[model samples]
Target: MSEILTITTDEVVPDREAVFEHQGIPAGRAVAAEIEALCTAAMEVFRQAAAPAGVLAEISKADFATLYKGDGQNEDATPVDEIYPRAKHLALFAVTVGEEVSRRIADGFKSKDFVDACMLDSVASASAERAVEIVQQRFLERATARSPAATKGEHRRLAGVPTGETPVPQFSSRAEKILDISSTGGDRRSPVDGVLAYSPGYCGWDISGQRKLFEFLKPETVGISLGESCLMQPLKSVSGVFIIGPKAIHLFDNCYSFCGRCTTHNCRDRIRALDAGG
Candidate 1:
């Protein structure tokens, strides 16, 4: 049986207004309030998507453990306390925007500095929304892919496809070839070219190593090549090591292959270890 999963949503504080003002934008309380509303709405969608199928449960601070499985080995792995002291399911929180927000920001852009900061914030917001959407879609895909095909007059299987079977249709040879190249290990190169060339949306990098890479590329520039397919979202900048549960960690690791042309050898090793049950 699938375990019950709980999801909670909350606003990320220290309002983006300060950041906006720092960039010379006239961000008053009104702007901050709107940003918070947008974040809350996006998070609600995320929370709804994350809950176990057909189990309507209220997500709150008390139930965070159900959603965020902590790292099995160390306290640092599941530092939900540090990441979301107010609530568990939320690991990192920040305000971000969609196309609508971007247009608004663009409308407010006055000078070069203002334009630059506004653009950066817009990218960050959009990126967050994209991240949430990608994660939710992945969950849906896995659940659906694992579900068995419906047999006419057969019992409805709500738990989704069974494990250890071919749940989805076979990939074409071309797709398999792309998957193989994308899944290659031990390289820290950008996987954008491969993923964009073969699949839709940009892929994620290893969380542990991405900070440095993000610093190198900067959030504003990271998704530029992907155009409308992948949006750049800025994660809250924070320090301290954080680790998720083994399963979640494994998921994040495998996602590296989706990155298309990554050069991080460690990520490949992690994927191999997970596959081997190490």
Candidate 2:
């Protein structure tokens, strides 16, 4: 039997209080504790999935941060232009197993021997893929249901694009430099394949359109791919016509897709200012 190795975010990143404050969310020690528990529980599921594959080891938070950092020294360091400055806190979880088990897990669905041998048996016999899917679904549902003290209005102001004096340009000329190294032309790729060009703006005249655009652009606008699955499969996928509009950064993790113009008074005021200026 493989030993279960469970590691908490505390082992990798600093406490959750700092992360929450960095995002401009109200800080509560109690709430932060609850959030940490939730993260641990979510990681537990991944640990269980790795049981049959062998002992699982997760990447350290410091390493993960460097991987996603915009200007880190890592070869795959996320580009500065692609980095969502507003999203300084990233909670990432990954699993690593032995080479033999890794091959079995990868080919499990196709080969019955591998499936029966390396599949996670703790919760009914399940392939690694299915086990991962179940965990992701549960995680997302819980995250979506949780209510924070910060209102949508508050979040927008904190993450809002500057308009006074000289608005800091979100996309710098270095975007081209970043794109030269990336696969796509720095286009915002959809999580779902072939479904290019979705704008809440095109669908309606309301803030929903603006919100959709924002979510699409918030991530470090990587190139779009057709039917590309995210690190977490079934939970996240990428698709066609990647257009990184202004709002994709916030939506990347929060999954809160609501129009800033509709809900955020400050955002509405900013839009009016721009309109008047135009």
Candidate 3:
């Protein structure tokens, strides 16, 4: 079952460095005063307009049987084949920075204010990503706090608006205390070491897989919608599976057919960062 994850604009605001990086402004370079001023203004607009929200559903292996293996159309081995089978826990999630930012970006373009539009676009993108990171971090804390003997059907809560039909799950005192300590940077070691999100359209997971992902997640409760091409509306939205387990499960060499033409190889950086944090 899925529950609404609490999110707020303040929590999802992108840092200046991330916003500048997304806008292709090199780090530590001498930026023009005007550019700096624009970034400040853009951030204000984003903070005012952005409505960050998300939904999370803890799932098991049987939840995605078809996605685990293809339907006979293609037989390419994907990273998830290595990751999911070994995951100690898994969840599907989606988050968005709201449509107002998208509308403002379009308005900027329509008004031929490319500079303002570009900065806001970068901020929105960064905010979307940051929201995901926040959700992932919270999930990490929850996973770490949970007792080893906790039942699979055990209910969990992430405060704020409860999304699905079910009532919000109450927090156990021990779990709540653990959450408080961990959120403040306590020194608790988690049974599960790491978590990384994998969306369709990457790592050989077909983009069309969004169909099933949406079926399970139903993120529209948070105002995100999937279109014909599996692209999410709000333009600044992200959806994917959270793979939780030891760092080893997430490791994979870039050897798929899609890898040769790929330029970024971002998965490498993500895995390395996870390892470093561990």
In angstroms, the error of model 3 at 175 is 32
Number of backbone clashes in candidate 2: 21
Off by over 4 Å in 2: 1-72, 75-85, 96-133, 141-150, 154-278
Candidates arranged by lDDT, highest first: 3, 1, 2
lDDT of 3 by residue, 22-91 (tens): 9787788788889889999999999889989999988888776565453333327778876787677889
- Tens digit per residue, CA lDDT, model 2, 1-278: 11233332223232334334433456664555554554444334334443222121122335333333323322322122232343322222222222233333345545664323322221121233233233233333343345222332333333342322221244222221211112234453222100012111221222222222223332222211112212212212111111111222322211123332234333323222221221
Q: Candidate 1 has what TM-score? A: 0.22
Candidate 1 regions exceeding 4 Å error are: 1-100, 108-111, 119-200, 204-260, 263-278
Pairs in clash, predicted candidate 3: none
> Distance from true position, residue 129, model 1, in Å?
4.7
Q: Residue by residue across 1-278, what tens digits does model 1's lDDT show?
A: 11122222222222345344434456453555665555444334333322111111123444333333322222233223332332112222112322343443444464444634453454344344333333333333443354432221111111121333222223222221222222324543221110000001122222333232223223332221112223233122111111222122122222323344545444444434332331
* Native-to-model Cα distance after best TM-score fit, residue 61 in candidate 3, in Å: 1.1
Better candidate by lDDT, 1 or 2: 1
lDDT of 2 at 175: 20
RMSD of each: 20.4, 19.6, 11.3
Indicate the worst ten consecutive residues by lDDT in candidate 3.
Answer: 152-161
Model 2 residue 141 distance off true place after TM-score fit, in angstroms: 4.5
Candidate 3: lDDT of 98? 94
C-alpha TM-scores of all predictions: 0.22, 0.25, 0.81
